[model samples]
Target: MYRKSKSNGKATYDLREVVTNIKWSTDLNFSAGELTFDLIQNAHPIIPYTGDIITFRWDHYKIFYGYVFKYEVKEDNTVSVTCYDKSRYLKNQDSIVWQSGTIADRFNNVCKRAGIKHKVVDKPTHKVSAEVCDGKTYFDMVKSAIVKTRTATKHMYYIYCNYDVVELRRAPYKKLKIIIGSKSAMTGFSYAVDINNTANVVKVIQKDTKKSQAKSATAKQDDPKRTSFKSTSAAGKSTEQWGKLQETVNKKNKANHAQMVKQAKDELRKKNRANKELTIDCIGHIDLVAGNAVTIKINDLGKTLKNCPILKAEHNFGTDYNCHLTMKVGAEWLGNS
Candidate 1:
């Protein structure tokens, strides 16, 4: 059953009876899910509108806590409501300065400035000497913090919203395993490899304030000078390469060149993994969500993908409480999985 309630616990509404359809989805790359649903408008006690706080619960699990951003009434007397997760509030809001603390501390500080409650499930061990959130939204600041923070093993962290709370956690390793085949719960599967978006090299430039100079570093896929090609039986190898250049102004005096190089390489790896994507569908797995580690075995491909992270997850519910899931899965090199 699905339920909507006020954030302050003042009132509650049971939407199961009137709900026609629901689409709840979340992503590791995005802070919030774009949630939408349709309801039969037959004198419902509460009218959902913009800025109203609503919590979506599927079965016993509270799936989403979001604020309604849009609503419309159809000619057929049905109401459609669109909502976004709490991170929507953080997207455009600025934060105060935070200095000399762990990534969790910085994250909590930003949440406090945004007036949102947050919880750190897995704290990142990396510590920063000084950090400032000037001229940047809370969302953008947190994303940068996640990229800077690393685990004891040097793996990057991930951020996501768990209902009303914001969670900072590490990427999934080989924790859960799922097999895809005709007899399994898997319903569909597909993959795509696009070289168009692949970047073999990344050039990161960081400006130095006091010195009035800019220090730059370049990270390449294989060899910085050599161009590598693969052989295909059908045709001779071609040398059409791709490259991405990123520049950031580092105001901090303590910024290290080695850290900047690592960051550049991490960014390149992320682009490479995103280029090779796989999507799969299955019966509703309530236990599955973004950031969960699962090993996927495909009989047709005759290969097992270990420590694959779920990039995106979509949960659909129908009139009769039927549920299904569609998820995008792939390797995220920054996670070191």
Candidate 2:
């Protein structure tokens, strides 16, 4: 998937598919290429003019079929012609030359129409010098050269085949439309899933274990150091008895301390067990882990929502131990446009 940051700070758009039904145009003289057919015009719409023609040695090329679609007279005493597509221009099936006169003419017209600018450039001579390479025929090579040339140029959001940019013209649409000329159908488009604003359905599941609760018990019985009572200056019999009594008390205390130590160890084991986890089949999926950001197409941003980023990526392990994901709700997610 191609990734880019959002142009607008508020939201980003991820394109899901290569949408069609857009308009496009090109520059071609009547001799080499055909002009679009207009019923009112006497010339065949798809036929090129073969007679002697007038050539203007200027920055842009213009032609006058039967009528002048647009005209501009500059201070230099040079009049220009602008051709507009009176009818629809179909893809592939029709080879029609679209125009709006000169670059200035098309620009002014497009400004009036509130549209962008798109240009198709001419192919280099060396590229079309030979046939297409690697199963690509001569026509395919020509088409490729045109598309590639346009793509190489800066500010070319889209490119088409057999199109030459003599001068700037009004864009066919108000928004960006990248149409891969029919020739490059094999390499149609690069796709990415639009995960924007999908947090409601794909929640992140936290992997944190809850803390166990129990009274804090000290292992005091396990402590080797303890106070002991001793008797001195007593009657010999009394002293002996006292000594015996002290020994018995010490033994009882040691046993009790040992029992408490064992109990403490057992309680710790139970707490560890509570935190243990296991893998199992036929289990439900949980929310993905919360993350920083994700990459996606620019056109996928819908009109309703805002920023959304990808969390954790999916992975596979040796069937025994697998990492789980936990997604927590948060603020805005950032992405490339």
Candidate 3:
């Protein structure tokens, strides 16, 4: 959508008519937003070359931006272009030691070093501990910092790129009050619930300074934490429903016992549920991208599900604009860090 002029200039082509089959994909599990479209070479007197900036905007908001990565010209004088947002650069490998500051601070540091423009939304104040990376991709280090924050402060966040800058946001950053139901313009719908990753028993293991394994089954009734000598915690829920799907966590002497106990409880809360996903497609809304929340009101599902988190969304533009999504069951499904 834009070109890098040899002189200082600012402009973008109005590509609405010359471009066709535009597709923009955003996924929480993917590193970047992607776009592909066909450009009619002859429709315009001049066409930008490779490495030119491309962007898509809807109304007042700029939705996607990236440089032209690939382009193919055919006998028909039509060009196929593929682009990816700035987060694509996060795939590059690096090594560093982040000693202090919240996850937001760490992300900003990474962006500065990588020469990528970035912004932050809904910051988490809890500071993450020191982390040293020998060799890891920038994306991997960011994910690692997120996991550390989740373990310590129990807050969740996600990353994406739009409007020419990478954005780090708390999970479900964009919230809409609108509801989607069976009456919506749905082309397809499928909701599934499975217990594939359920767990009811969590065992905590500790190794001594001498490098010996230790597991004791003694505790003091007077202590509320019950962490005096406990190494395992089991959910009160009947194991008959899910027979002792066990998980384990290792800790060092430096970690407090109470923290370990709460860690076990956290594991149980996250793993004991039936993971539910509702996949659907309808007429596209520019705002309906990933890392947002949508309300669902179907007949079979009661009030148990509201504000479901969107895991991925793909908006296809051709004859019509349509979007489909993969969404989780409830707000907790996204926030249960």
Alpha-carbon TM-score of each model against the true structure: 0.71, 0.15, 0.81
Q: Model 1 Cα displacement at 78 (Å)?
A: 1.0
Quantify all predictions' global Cα lDDT against the true fold: 0.63, 0.23, 0.74
- As a whole number from 0 to 100, the lDDT of residue 244 in candidate 2 is 22
Please give, for residues 1-337, the per-residue lDDT of candidate 2 as tens digits.
Answer: 0112223342322211221111112221111112221111123221112221212111132321121233344444333333232111111121213232222332223223322232423222222122214533222222333333333332111121122121221111122122112132111222233322221111111122333354357653322333333321111233232232111111223334445444333332222111111111111111111122211122322211111222222212222312222211122111110
Off by over 4 Å in 1: 1-10, 43-46, 150-153, 177-182, 199-274, 319-337
Tens digits of lDDT, candidate 1, 1-337: 3444455464667777777668887676746776888888665434676777777776667788888889898777788888888777677666467777777886787777777778888877777657767788876777766666542345656667888887777777226656544357667677666666444455555432233244447552333334332211111122233334332323224546666566555555554434556777766765567777566667777757665667777877663332233334554434222
Candidate 2 structure lDDT: 0.23
Deviation in Å, model 1, residue 218 alpha carbon: 31
Off by over 4 Å in 3: 1-14, 40-50, 59-61, 73-78, 206-231, 236-238, 253-260, 300-304, 331-337
Q: Candidate 3: global Cα-lDDT?
A: 0.74
Write model 3 residue lDDT over 44-157, tens digit each, in one string: 434556667787875556778787778887778888888888998888788998897787887888888889999987788988778898788888778888877876766778
Off by over 4 Å in 2: 1-142, 146-301, 304-337
